[model samples]
Target chain A: MAEPTPELIQRAQRGDPESLGALIVGQQQYIYSIAMSVLRQPEDAADLTQEACMKLLRVIGQYNGESRFTTWLYRLVVNLGRDELRRRGRRVPEMPPMSDDDGEVIDPLQSLADDDRWADPAAVATNTELQGEIRQALDSLEDHYRLALTLYYFEDLRYNDIAEILDVPLNTVKSYIRRGKERLATILASSESEKIQPPRTVAKSDVPVSQPRLARFAWALGRR
Target chain B: MEHCKEYRTNLALRPDGDTAELSQHAATCPECAKAAKRAAAFDTVVQSAVMPMVPDDLTARLLALVPGLAQPMVRSKRWLRQRRAFFAISALLSVIGVAVLIYGLYILGSYVGVSEIWHTQ
Candidate 1:
């Protein structure tokens, strides 16, 4: 992969299309994965990746190169994804618990189960079970936790890089990762073990509480 | 309190703290040991979930969408932004210039005693 060199950055910053293309091609997957992990939707992830690239181009001059290009990109993409998710008024959706006899729901242990391995071909092919489990657990995680885990683990970034990307302190990033892991574990475990637990009622009243004006605008956009 | 505080600090610094003293203490202290084990398990689970190996085409797709490169809309929008900033600065300067002109005229008139003459008239 071609590194984001000073010349390429300069040309891209100057609005050179070729340089921009090279940069985008280089980082598209990284940006897209982050978006997908956060949005949990392929289409939404694609849109955000495109949007982040565009935004990056527009603000390239503002980048002082104080951090790695990838770190800056991570921050940009995650922030956009979070904003997009919030604008859509989509909180973590709850997963249905597994059921036992008598139709009683059980709380499944929601950590990364022994079955959820990225390397296993069988696991990858018939990933419905694992995917569903991950989706459920991830959806239950707070936005910050989701971002931290996605950036740190999925992106294979270091703690300091994640801290830079999330614009948080190093300790804060660690805390987020730790807490996020605990939450995922609890959610996954609870989902697996208590799969028969009854579904909770989701509220329908939509007076738009606590969402910012921009979020309200995005929510309206998301409706379309 | 001191022992508990030291343990908590050690736990926070390195989740996998393997110090002999910490290990012995954890074995003796059920709470610390449980917390340590939980932390270790949590670490393993997170390591597995990240799935760092990205798809091969990810980089290509990313580069394809880069602004001012692949997307015409981005180029257009960037041009529009530059145009907007230019116009905004121009308008601001125009306003400042008008304000300065008014102030200059008022000061010149005052220096020439025009205000006194106007007051008499």
Candidate 2:
């Protein structure tokens, strides 16, 4: 995540119009990516992304500067997503308040941090039209779970960071990733094909190797 | 495959990489190990596939919708155009309000026989 400079943040806080615009442009992609990944239809995702931008402008003054500005910005987008879900009459997860639960909460991040998190930073397998298949499976999961995966996998946020943005417990974020993956596995299993090779491109720079959704694509094929 | 369930469950939990327990379990249990490795590989595919591909003009396009970010904070042309009706309504209301206030004051003065244009000073 690109941390906006303190000078930039202060300029935004001071309501410098240019600074505000800079802030929006800087975070637009991350917000758009999350919105696109979670929602099934591209149009809906586009609509929600626009809504989030307007929302940020409408409420920018309310930003207290207590939490990281990015977190606050994400929360705004998440809330907009929740609102969209509500409008569609789809069931959505309850949003928790963003209290100062920092160290006060029993974050199990440390225990898992050393082992689980470090297990396989880069995914190293793939084959065929795994992209569309994964998208289909992803859309099938519940909105909250999909949002969790979007944050954890795509946005590359930590469990606690996701929990903070979604305003849920860390365990809940962990549970969401686990369940979402399992559900995705089940859906992709419904279809099959062969041929394999990992994609040469992973826009993300942090991890050299990307995930194995194609492995699951083949893994799902093997089960059939 | 006894440890497979726990291993898979753990696989789902971690943000990146495999956990030590999962790695250890996979080491001894070939069935689960292979499955875990494959599953992890599939995870990589999922990440790459599911990534959102946005347009180069996405920021400009989306920022256009944001109320303040798209235009200047003060008296932007778009802002003026969007709020013209509002400003007009406000202006009308102010004109009416001043007229009513003057009329009311005139009536009050006339009733008390104080002063009026018709009655002179």
- The alpha-carbon RMSD values of the candidates against the true structure, listed in the order shown, are 23.5, 19.6
> What does candidate 2's lDDT look like per residue over A18-105, in tens digits?
8877887787767776777556577777777778877777777787778777778877788787777788898766543233322232
Which stretches of candidate 2 lie above 4 Å from their native place?
A89-128, A193-224, B1-9, B15-36, B65-121
Cα lDDT of candidate 1 equals 0.63
lDDT of 2 by residue, B48-99 (tens): 6556766655666665664455453346688888799788999999999999
- Candidate no. 2 TM-score: 0.57
Per-residue error for A176 in candidate 2, Å, reads 1.5
Candidate 1, B2-57: lDDT as tens digits: 55445644543353335777667877887565555544444444444443344554
CAPRI tier of model 2: incorrect
Best by TM-score: 2
Local lDDT at B46 for model 2: 71
> What is the Å distance of residue A70 in model 1 from its true position?
1.8
